[model samples]
Target: MQIIMSGLIMGCIYGLAALGLVLIYKTTMVVNFAQGEMAMLTTFISFGLLTKYNFSYFVSFTGALIVSLILGAVIYAVFMNRVQAADHLNQIVITLGLFLIINGVAGLLWGHQPESFPTPFSDKVIPIGSALITRNDIFIFIFTLLLMGVLYVLFNFTKIGLAMRASAQDLTASRLMGIKVPLVFMSTWAIGTVLGSVAGMMTAPLTFLSPTMMFDILIMAFASAVLGGFVYMPGVIIGGLIIGVFGNVVSYYYSPEMKVVYTFLLIIIILYIRPQGIFGGKQTVKKV
Candidate 1:
């Protein structure tokens, strides 16, 4: 039961992490490989606000989100926009370069050491039907659910969300309809960065803040996004949960290091069986 609860908490974090990847992939058709690095960098920013500036969790979280938004916008404006006409390989390479650059910056700024993070939740545990659940785990689960709900509402009910979806479907048509494509793209990147930062800040209490923290998680997130068909929100959540649980189970039964290996194997098998992924719809490409 303890293991199950732990998996659930970890699964929520993975899902939230995957959410940013899905958003960027859906809107721009470019996988921002620097996503994990962005998360790491934002986590450090949150830490700085919390420990150095003596800010409360809420204050630091808000500051981190704002900074992440600006960083995302700047990244898209400076790097991604230039690659709009480039091929997939070029885009991937550019993002990869950004990934390395951010990682180096993090190391230079924060060093390679891990730091403890404080959480609002107490360390007390509650027992329910022979299962023990910690307050931190409960907080993580509840916060992730609330975040996802807010995202759903924003995407479904907001005008900006509608424009984003339209831009994702057809950039030219959306532009013709007077939608600002560049702004939409920038907003998408900002949204993705905000989500990633939120996930990073939340997970910091459980995993600690470190430069390499996002590397392994990024691979897990990419697998989750790919398994869920990349762009589907529900599918991404489900995929993350599946991978999280499976990895936990494998670690419990086998070795912890084998989890990533098994995940990659699962991804290869899934790709072979269904290249479009579990929830991906058939896309018709219009020839230029």
Candidate 2:
């Protein structure tokens, strides 16, 4: 039971990581391959603030978020905005370049070693009947759920959210309707970066801070996003939880090393069966 609980906590973190991917894909129709690197970089920022300046968690978190948002905006202004008629391949190449740059920068700044991170929750474990859960696990689960709820409300009830949705659906139409399309695009990237940074901070305590931490988790998060449907929030969350639980079950039943292999296989099977994703509807392509 403790193991199951641990998997669920980890799944929530993956879901948060995938949420950033979904946000970017939904709005821009571009998969930012650099997302993992962005998370890693922001986490390093938090670590620097905490270790060098001895800043509080909240302060460091805020600073990291701000820096990440600025980075996201700059990436868009410098690269994404210039891709006027570029294909998906071009966008992917650009993002991949960003990924290498960020990864290299992180390694240069922090070295290739793992660093300890302070957790807001106590390390003590509490027992509920036969099941034992740590405060950190509970904190991660609750924090992720809270963030999801906030995002749900923002996308469902806010005007800006509606504009974003409109832009995603039809950018030219939305622009013609007087919406600030570029701003909406920038906002989407900003939100994605902020969420990614938060996921990084939350995960650092569990996984330890390393230059390559996001590299491994990024694959799982992408699988989660694909399994859930690129634009479906609820589906993404459920997919993440399923992957987390399933991976752990596999690990327990077999070797722990097979977890990633099983996850990728599961993703491939799901894609083969439902290419639009479990929650995604088939999009009709208009005849040109």
Candidate 3:
């Protein structure tokens, strides 16, 4: 029960990050390799606001998310928009460039030292049966769920969400129907970045804050996205939970060092068996 509960909490973190990745992929048809770095950068910014400037946690958190939103929009407008008509490989290269740039910038600014992140959550422990859980763990779980719920409501019930969905489905058709494709694209990036920022904020407290903090988590998040079906939303959530549980169980029974290796192997095997992913719909190839 302890391992399972811990896995579920960690799964929510992975799921949140993967959700951001899914959003960008769904709308722009581009995998943002810089997703983790972007989150890390904003997290550092939040840390500065909290410690250096002596701001409240709420203010720091909201400020970081807003900055992430703007940064995402700026990247899309100034870089991605120019390369919008390029091949997919070109877009990917651009994001890879961003990954390197952001990582280096973060290291230079933050000095590559790891620091403990401050959290508003209490450190109190709660006992459930034979398992012990931290208050922060429960807080993380609820916060992630609330974020997911907001996204669901936005995507399913709002006009902007409809436009976003339509834009993702068919860019030209959506434009023909009076949807502003560019704006939709920008908004998608903004929202994705905001999600990533939230993931980063939640994550920093568990792990120490550092420039490279998000690297391993990013890998797990990518695996989660692949397992859940890159284009499907709910699948991402389920996939994250599966990964969390699998990794914890492996660490418990086997070598902790081998856990990541086994996790990747499991993902590869599952993909080989079901190319479309567990919950992913069958792909339709268009004949031109």
Off by over 4 Å in 2: none
Candidate numbers sorted by TM-score from highest down: 3, 2, 1
True-structure RMSD for candidate 3: 1.1
Best by lDDT: 3
Q: For residues 11-87, what per-residue lDDT tens digits would candidate 1 score against the true structure?
A: 78788889999998888989899999999999899999999999998899899999999999999999999997799
Give lDDT tens digits, candidate 3, residues 1-288: 998898888888888899999999998888999999999999999999999999999999999999999999999998889888899999999999999999999888888989999988688889988888898888888988888899999999998899999988888899999999899999999999888888889899999899999997899899999999988988998898899889999999998788789999999999999998878998776666
For residues 21-127, what per-residue lDDT tens digits would candidate 2 score against the true structure? 89988988889899988988999998889889999888998999999999888888888878735899999899999999999998998899898888876789999
Taking all chains together, each candidate's TM-score versus the true structure is 0.96, 0.96, 0.97
lDDT values of the candidates? 0.88, 0.87, 0.91
lDDT of 3: 0.91
How much does each candidate deviate from the true structure in C-alpha RMSD?
Answer: 1.4, 1.3, 1.1
